[model samples]
Target chain A: MVAENKGIEPGGGIVLDGISHAYSGRKALDNVSLTVPRGESMALLGPNGAGKSTLLNILCGLIRPDAGRAIVAGVDVSKHSSEARQNIGVVFQDDSLDDRLSAWENLEFHGLVYGMDKPSRARRIDEVLALVELSEWAENPVRTFSGGMKRRLEIARALMHEPRILILDEPTVGLDAQTRAKIWSYLNQQRRERDLSVFVTTHYIEEAESCEAICVIDHGKVQVQGPPADLKARYGTSLIRCLPRSPEVRQKLLEKYPEAQRLSGDRLGIVVRDQAMIDAFLSEFGSSLKEILIDEPSLETVFLAITGREMRERDEVNSKARGKRNKRI
Target chain B: MSKLTILGRGIYAIWLREIMRSFRDRGQLIGGVSRPIIWLLILGIGLNPYFRGEIYGEVRFVIPFTYLQFLFPAVIVLNIMYTSILFAVSMIWDREFGFLREVLVSPLPKWAILFGKILGGSTVATMHGFLVLILARFADVTLGWDQVAWALVLMFLLSFGLTSFGVILAARVRSFEGFGVFSNTIILPLYFLSSSVFPLDPSLTRTQTAATYPEWLAMLVQINPITYAVDALRGALIGFNQFDPWIGPSIIGAGAVLFFFIALVDFKRQ
Candidate 1:
């Protein structure tokens, strides 16, 4: 079965079949399975400690999953990491460029490490540097580059080898909105030009909205995986917030709709299913309610609906677990 | 292209980066230049006149050379030891600052990357050792071009072994702050105990050996692998050998292979 899978069609993709990994005694990833087809952009959405890192480590051939297989570009990552790595390029969450070397030198080193010929190394170094609009600073040390420029250089270096799949871990976490958009543009250009399978893992809901598909994971388990529109439609809620003018109206509204939640600021929120529900709500309590606000369904709401936990509340636990797992080989 | 050619390019890429980094590091260059000068020019000259072994107004034993000539080859060894062992800083920098992952994720194997790094370090260390050889005329030690070339080979092998030793140190050390203590404890004791400065020869006259050095000191010197390395350099540069000449090259040759494999084991684990 493993031999049959090697270099199959849709070779520029990733497949994880029941990949489970544990660090010491605690489970970091538990029987997780997902796929990124060729020429597709998929986001692995998770907060810290949601097993995103462990899955990434396995995909990049940094660590082998305790059970199951990780196949990248039709090569089993654990069994044939060198071949898998040849087909995949990675941009880590940490800054990995040599600060002492110039931007051109960094990309050149990358080209050589990937075993490009001298002529191609020179040509691709020019092409990638220009792609990121870093040709002017090509001779400048990376230490002098701004955070965004460094990020751009890293993106350029990752693509210099011209790998079929590009894996980025939280590519644009701290950048400003303009830089974030520019980075996306560079990434999107690669996809359009090379039909690259771009797999990115990020916690940013707005960022994940731009991908073709989204996978939401939490507590080492994937809760939902589908297109953004499908996820938002299936699990995302459209809430109708009603602020009652009088306590009697509030009591009547609460009795009529048991699911009506008393929201702060003296308002009640109801998960209105369809237009009929909104119409029925308006006809019954149009005069009693002082104000009404409609909240549309979005990926944010879908995440909250699926996870049922506040991101901020898990910050401490997640960071501690992330730290402990990072120390493991 | 063949797979071998591709892997060779990857190793060259890694090695080229180290050479470029070393060239740019002015502080390291300064140390490489200043360390040899202080030991050879100042220390050698200051202690030259007082080096003769004399007792009861008669010379007990003669070393057959001036203090400056005797100290010249050892200073070369000292310079090589410093540069080679401190090559760990580059390894530490890569691991600490995330540059290691860039290479780690590449298609090349672990041993290829490590070999490139060790080769780069050994090359720089060999150059640092050569800096002292250029000053040989001032030490009154005349050498033919053949001697210089032979010493380079021995120096490079010693550097290769010590650079691998540095990589071993890098794997065990958690941070750079501890390296200050590591060099003082490890590099210093290894240098002093290798008989680089003090020649503790077992073949010396019994009275000369007994009056000057202790039995324990001679034991430490003989057991030290670096003693053979320094001895090899002394043989190459000044035609001096306190032990069997083959012993020096054998230990150095064995160390180069042994430490490299050991370092490779640690690197693959990472």
Candidate 2:
């Protein structure tokens, strides 16, 4: 047993060790292990039924895993969930705000739940509402707000107590592109401003690229976990595609880039290690092939290169299996 | 902050919210007071003639007032029980709206949540009873200040017990319609069998000398906790009761404790 702090502590992020959980007789999360170090942002990427929610629930102390340790901000969740809840804030995937209450009332109620005094709670509510640009709408009930506004208010409410760790379960899902971008920017700004650790689950691969660390999980297990650049480099740094006009051009392209692998009928795929190689390939083969494309190694490509299947495909198979399991039960 | 302070704040917040919402809801406030007012006026007046001059031979228990005065405390009991049970529906509403998850995830203890809700619901129900107390003059029942104070205490106790029981039921219920069905099926029968609307002693006696009620009905009323509450309220307000003065409060207090523990356990499990 590790010695635990009694009150709110700073910058002690999440740690899950060999956590295994099952629902009924089926495994929901198997040997899931990850760490979000103090004051660093980490994104958890996974498909549906990939145990993203299960892991988040464990971190937030909502559910205890069958077999393993989950320590959030230095408090063991299974042993002292109420104390662990003190150092962490959660924005659930579902709408958890009280629609009947005004924005200020919701914040006030949350503040009171967290045991904040009247003066501090009042001051903090004003500060957070202003931070979310919702100061003007503070008196309006949440049911009257737009989707983006409500999402922002939820974020604001989660930050009311200035939790050291913020765990958001798909915070930007179902939002417009602009709203998603704005939310990401706000999160990034808050992270830098407060030096807060963030453990977020997101389906959007592109947005996840901004995180300090990324863990791509599938089929209830982590496929890869590392800094974005390291994971991308471990697979291939970049991908170069050349579409030849004829078999003769294809042969010429293959001779020029000997490492190229045949891709579908007359196209060839080559993995490049550096930008210099991509520039050279594009410069020399620009006119020879019908089309040539150089693609930077993105988080999406890294996930695909390592998983051997698309994220969506894995979700479809998992859901179908789950449907069968549910039917049997 | 101290642990007690946290629990106190949580209770205060929940109680304030319930009181605020209850006052803001015009329909609920009006309905809570009007239902019993209608019963006290039309039903009490209509039933007065039947029992105006009728008398039963010496018995250990009886309502020593007019039929209208006899029915007044029962009408208040009916309103308190109804409002307390209906307040539990808000729990299902909170669950459906996802607001319960927020409360559950907080650092506050589970007992505090249940305690706060019971206190809130009871406060509102007690306020409703006070509103009905104002109608005592119209029904020709005069009460001294001491009696009014004691009656208020009984009203609070009864509301707390009924609200605790409602919270226990609400913890298991998932939907408003489901709660409505369960409470109606259970609460209405409890009220009818508790001797709230009628005297426990029948007008005519058979072989029995102490009281005139049937053996089975007396057994049920004695077993019903609300019967004690109404009887206590009647004793406090009109100086007449079916049970001893101490029996009503003691049983109701113990029952409130039991209901509160049941609700606490269920909420903690969730």
Candidate 3:
């Protein structure tokens, strides 16, 4: 069976099977299985508490799963964690660079730790610094860099050893639009140039669209997994917004097209099943419609449909629970 | 390179990084050495007359040596304890900042990381100890070759033992505040209770004090590596041999090895 699995992909990638993890009796991951093929960028998309970070930790050999196996670059991460880690590079969500150390020193130290020789370490440090557009800042202390620069340095540090598989956990959580785009461009370019297998987790739906494939996870399980276009094509529909100006008009519109899902206040929403049904209803009450907007279903909607809660709502709820627990203590 | 060689290189790389970090924070490095330097200067000067004053018809001697004689060993041990505790604080900060996870995830063995940290902290401690010694010499403290060798050896062993103890405490602590509490509750008591400052004589009252506590305390002091460390320094610096001629150094060497092993085990479990 192992040989058969290996035959499916001749080169390096990651495979997670039946991975389960828990923290303090609360299940963080429930039988999560994912296969990231060679040379493909897979985006693990989820809201908070969806176990994306936990799964990434398992893939990176930082934590062991209670039940399941992770194979990274043909090495079992759980059984041969050290070897597996050697073949992979991880960029954590939080900044892990030594603030006091200069960028060059940081890269040099990490390269040496990865067992790179002095010459290669120096050469590769230069290469990665250029790759991340941090060549000029390489001699400056990391503490002096901006948030975006620090993030770029972190990526440079991770890539110093030239690992085949790169794992980035929430890589662009707090960055300006331009900086995020810059990082995305660099990552995509690097992937193309090196044929690297990239595994990234993100809360931003826009970021998810760039991945070759995406896995939408909610509450520790995958809600939908496929190529970006396919997932959107399968579940997406033209959104129709009809501002009826009153609850009575909203009720009448809902009654008219009962199949159309009521998104918010009966005015702004999408018809997931059929577009013509919305068209016919709009024709009947076309003049009454204050405004009409149409677009394909977003990952946000997919998350809502799967988890039965909005992303921000869930975060607010979690924060409240955490606050209450903290207060109680 | 072989795996072990790679591991060793990784450990050295981390150790060098730690040393560089310590030096980069000039204020902290300077401040870490300042307290002991002041103690050496002020206390050594103020208490010299008291030690020379006659007591009970016997001329009390402050061991009849330079100020460094009294302060050198104590300062070295104190440097080890202080620097190791500071390293523990950095370890706690690393935990908060998520760097510990990065180190833990690396291919380097856990023991290498722990021992690397201990060695790194010890190196800083040893350097600080030597700096104080150099300063002491400038203050007219004469040192023979034997005394210098004994001080160097004692400095290294004391550093190793105290750093190992610091690692154990760091591995067990969850927060900086918790570490502070541990340092205050444990470090100060250990320093004072031991013979680092005063002599441990077999006088009836002192024996009674040792007896009332857990046997380990007195045994640990008698066998306490620091006791031998202090004794060794005393023998060299003041020409006073307080401990058993041969057994003291052996016990200290043995105990340091034991502490190192315990630290390694604790690190792995963590």
List native contact recovery per candidate, as a fraction of 1.
0.89, 0.77, 0.72
The most accurate candidate by lDDT is 1
DockQ each: 0.74, 0.55, 0.67
* Model 3 Cα interface RMS deviation (Å): 1.2
Q: TM-score for every candidate vs. truth?
A: 0.88, 0.83, 0.85
Lowest summed lDDT over 10 consecutive residues: which window, candidate 2 chain A?
Answer: A320-329
True contacts kept of 1: 0.89
Clashing pairs in 3: B220-B224
Candidate with top DockQ is: 1
lDDT of 1 by residue, B1-270 (tens): 788988999999988988898889999899889988999999988988876776578963357678888889888888888998899999999999999999988989889999999999999999999999999988999999999899999999999999999999999998898986887798889888887877777565455678878778889988988889988988998888888888898899899999999999999887
The list of candidate 3 runs beyond 4 A from truth reads A1-6, A239-271, A276-294, A310-329, B53-68, B138-140, B202-228, B245-255, B258-266
| Ranking of predictions according to DockQ | 1, 3, 2
Q: Which interface RMSD values do the candidates have, in the order shown?
A: 0.6, 1.1, 1.2
Model 1 TM-score is 0.88
Which window of 10 residues has the lowest lDDT sum in candidate 1 chain B?
B199-208
